[model samples]
Target: MTNEFATLSDFRALLAGAALADADMFAAASEHNMQLTKPPGALGQLEDLALWYRSWRGGDNAEIAAPQVIVFAGNHGVAARGVSAFPAEVTAQMVMNFQHGGAAINQIARVNGATLDVVALDLDQPTQDFTQGPAMSENEFVAALQAGWQAVDATADLLVVGEMGIANTTSAAALACALLGGAASDWTGRGTGVDDAGLSVKTQVVAEGVALHGGQGDGLETLRRLGGRELAAMAGAMVRARCLRIPVILDGFICCAAALCLAKTQEGALDHAVAGHQSAEGGHARLLEALGKAPLLHLGLRLGEASGAALAIGVLKGAMACHASMATFAQAGVSDS
Candidate 1:
């Protein structure tokens, strides 16, 4: 597993030594921006996003092509305990929905010209409820991550990770609390539109799970304690995208939690990603802050499945188009301000 997918130490090493976007290209993009007819910093973060892609690709004409979103679907053992408003069956059903392109993510991806795929991480057999015990063994966790690492297509120039698993927000909150020294009460939200009573139960489940594991494991141990398969895969996918130089636009709270885990194991892992949007989830803003990421869009979106990231894809494309095709002041025959 370590050889094929990289061990925790290897992940740490890879991330620590990973190269960032090219410095020369970044300088070039900044210079080119000043050459435009508009005054400096006119486009705000859009200018920043343009420069980021320029540096990421080490090119003056950076363009994102072959964008794809992979939604990892799994069933949480905790969901069987009524932690979610929806039943556990919805996880599997949603996986089918993603494959059939009937979900919101599909429509957004279609409009954005991004391909979508769903990876099912058959969790029932291996994952026990963390509230009862560890979610899975170390080997199982590694296998789940490897699935994500392998699922990344080489042709992909951009990636977005979305997840679907009933009660997953419970797992995400537990993992976040464990990693951030937060409380379940602060981290857990009413996922899937749960009522107050259901939210209370879910929070209790998270607290119990974290307590059972002492909330003191290394990255992998904590993941095994309270993480979901979809999350593990998302973290793995984030790591792989960094290695492959494909920038990832992350979805909502759940994906942010996975990004947190990635950073915990490999510092600066979030540097390769742009936060897609701010989810209305209670813990999402905190997660993005921890990663030092300001999302591209904010529409109170709490619906996961990479929908937020898909919406941001258009923004990214426009940023690139501006970067690559927008005329310089000289070409436009206009004086720079």
Candidate 2:
């Protein structure tokens, strides 16, 4: 078994002297933000997110070297409950869009020059396509975890994990309830645009699932019970990314739930995570707050295609560019009285 650094401190110590680059990158980015032709704090969260990215990179004045987004595709068995407005088949259809470059996330990825990797995990229903990617099974999940570990091992400086599955929000909510130490009622929400009655039914479905599988002790058990294969696989991937000292950007609710699982399992996994956006769903805000993370975008988007993370890539790039290009107060010949 590979040794997993369980906390941010351990990961930090592991990085040791190699982490110097991260510091230079952050300091440079901070200086550049000050020279953005505005007041120092004008950009608010954008400035902060950029600085945060710099910190993650060891502040080595590093550029956003290779930004990659992995879209974890799966199906949710719970969509049969009418919880989500779209049918479960939409998951596979959207995967097709992701592959064909027809989705919003695809456009954003293209614009940012980020490579997109799609992994299909089998936690919900199985898909019919062989050309998309590997089908996630029990063995496949572990293999994907290993593959995820290797893919994100070193070369890429930043990675974002995105998901596509109708009714995944329900799975995410249940997982949140277990991992966040809350009741199902606290995390469950109208996933797509369910009617009031549909919402009520949706909550009951999640509640029942929680009741059936609630006592698994918050890590793998929570994953085993409420997690889809993709969610489970991503949970491990998030931990591995943190262990490898790479930053992981989480897409909306589903991804946040996966992050929550990893954070609960590993003490400082949250340190490696950047919340990409808050979903319109009710529980997403609570999840972000639990992690003490603020998202980079909130376009009221509920789509689960990693689009928000893709858009935030630009903000990160800007932050990196600002750090690399901005002149210092001394360089600008501004006297320090």
Candidate 3:
């Protein structure tokens, strides 16, 4: 969480305080896995998943006791540029839908045993269109990010961060290009099913935004300059979850962009984050690659708001169950054939 600092230097201190994962449990889990009845590395990804939990928790045993998906909702001023098929108002409507238990994220969260939370930012402001000046004042961005960090569940065994906004893809793409030296055309995709012309405009907007603010500073600085409220909040949640030793599963492209920002501020922030899925959006795979993460699932999932992470939580649960339940070779009384 953000510390009580009113200045940029002090804010940097708060961001720099994200803690690292301890490996004592990881060492023990590795030894236990080798002693399990199965062949070495038989469980494949499940073993990796179990070890991940143990490592981050700094314990030999870990379970996803309470899973959560916190969705940060905001509106994007760049949507005025006609980037998305849906208007910015849809962001609020979807927030209502999510609260009403009607959106895809709600259903997935219920089925996967995750509590859903929504942090609605100022849709009315939408941050001054980045194409003009800074999207928002540093004060507004800092406060919104702090709100997100506070929204994270400190007791949660697994944290999944998602976002809701119109034309946020443009912001995410621009941030990606600026921080990773990518081209807008390569990172921008059809968000909310834009037409060919809309795609061109979106691409141009991202390209222009990146050119305007690219290479200005580190990841967090780039995020502050080119990101939307939802994106900034997601980064805050990620950094805080890592600080609390809670594992995080990042949603799609927008989520990954925020994760990249968190990673920049805290080296190995990705150590506490797992890519829930590879988004169908353009540049998500590239972003994941840049973060050195292999997603757990892929279903062409493009709906933001943590839908992908909600669905993937079950997989993590199943993997953790296997690690916690399987009997060792001696317990099973099985020969090492």
Candidate 4:
């Protein structure tokens, strides 16, 4: 795929100039929702969700017919530090499982009628251990972002980006701590089912990485220093989705950390996206709170393959169906008392 951005500056420019949702369409959708046979606000958050979707889609009859899920896989050198319960090679093996349709995200995507694409980024060349130094150089970081930007399908009306990387949750914690100005312990969590001792190690690693790389006040730089290739790609995909006016259902902690990079870089950068669900990861709730995003579901999920977001697609589709297909009081021959 062609590179849309040659430098982080270019990407930042795109984020700064990204278009906002269509107000006219949003107003129309809100009015139509009130006219439905059901009482106003009866659908609760679904009502707002449908309207928010319509605003980006720019139509009174917007429907989620073409949703796309992209799962990015990358190896992190930090896994060698015993931050996770799984080996780094599991990232590549899980990518294969996704390709073979054997993963939970595969089944969830299929059920949501969404096409899935898996992008494996240099699994053989794991990033540098971030505690020692930056995870990726600027060129490598830009390349990862372009990988995510090119992975998006223009035909897709909605987008969901996920990741598969061992020790990525550690990366996410460090990234979040660097961006959100919190202690490492507040952002760190037991990723991949790490035991208590492992969690302590993970927390210390996060602290060290953030101490070495944090407080730069540059989101992109922090992302390059602390985030994985897959995390960068997820950030890239979300930016591309914004440019295309495609609404996104953000996944869990890792996905949110990637998004936080964009959000911190530009105001309203995540205006086209919504939190799909809150993960069981200890830091996920804090991340969501920082983003000012209330998750649509909270089933204690921490599976990172975009499983939660893909499943939330059904919830969005249900909202769209009720908004676009349900009859108004006049059409249903019901009195509007």
Best by TM-score: 4
Leading candidate by lDDT? 4
Give a tens-digit lDDT track for model 2, residues 1-337.
Answer: 4544443334334433222225666676666677655457766666777677766766556678688888887776666667788888787787787888888888888899888888766534542221121223344445444544544545677888788887778888877776676777789888778888888877887777777667655455465456676676576666666655677778888888877766676556577677777878879999999888888888888877778877888887886676666665668776434
What TM-score goes with each of the models?
0.95, 0.81, 0.96, 0.98
lDDT of 4: 0.93
Error of 2 at 329 (Å): 2.6
For residues 219-312, what per-residue lDDT tens digits would candidate 4 score against the true structure?
A: 8889999999999999999999999999999999999999999888898999999999999998899889999999999998989999999899
What is the clash tally of candidate 4?
0
Order by lDDT, highest first: 4, 3, 1, 2
Q: Higher TM-score: candidate 1 or 4?
A: 4
Screening candidate 3 with a backbone cut-off below 3 angstroms (N, C-alpha, C), the clashing residue pairs are none
Q: Please report the TM-score between candidate 4 and the true structure.
A: 0.98
- In terms of lDDT, the poorest run of 10 residues in model 4 is 55-64
State each model's CA lDDT, in order: 0.84, 0.69, 0.84, 0.93
Poorest 10 consecutive residues of model 3 by lDDT? 1-10
Point out the higher-scoring one by lDDT: 1 or 4: 4
Off by over 4 Å in 2: 1-47, 123-144, 150-153
- Model 3, position 242, has a per-residue lDDT of 74
Model 3: per-residue Cα lDDT over 1-337, one tens digit each: 4355565556567667766666667888888877777888887898898888878876545557699899999888889999999998999998899889998898899989889898899977887788776776788888777877789888788999899999999999988888888578999999789999999999999888887888777887788788888898887777677778888888999999988886776676678878899989999999999999999999998988898888989989987877777788889998877
